[model samples]
Target: MTAKPMTAAGASRASVLFPAVAAFAIGFGLIFMSGLVQAETLHDAAHDVRHATGFPCH
Candidate 1:
């Protein structure tokens, strides 16, 4: 048996992933580029996030 060629309908489904990947890249870039942030501020933010996510950081 021969494989079927790809059509726009199948290709369109793959396009849905681009926005989610872009959003993750943008958010991570913002966090990484904010270098002037104080250590205490970063620690507090991380601590808060850990608690919010129920992840043990200690």
Candidate 2:
């Protein structure tokens, strides 16, 4: 059986798709890891940033 070469459109789609998939995977992994942390710990870490952004934590 002969193998088909990738067309320009397919190559372009793959290039865009790979980075998007990689980014989604990385983001999901980070959220999953953060979920394992205690709520208070996460709150403490983001406390300063929240206040800086004028977000009320109280």
Best by lDDT: 2
Model 1 off-target regions past 4 Å? 1-13, 35-58
User: What C-alpha RMSD separates each model from the true structure?
Assistant: 6.9, 5.6
**In TM-score terms, which candidate is top?**
2
Worst 10 residues of 1 by lDDT: 30-39
lDDT of 1: 0.62
Per-residue alpha-carbon lDDT of candidate 2 for residues 1-58, written as tens digits (9 for 90 to 100): 8966878666667588989999999998775444434468776886666557665553
- Model 2 segments more than 4 A misplaced: 1-11, 36-58
**What would the TM-scores of all predictions be?**
0.34, 0.40
* Model 1 per-residue lDDT at 46: 74
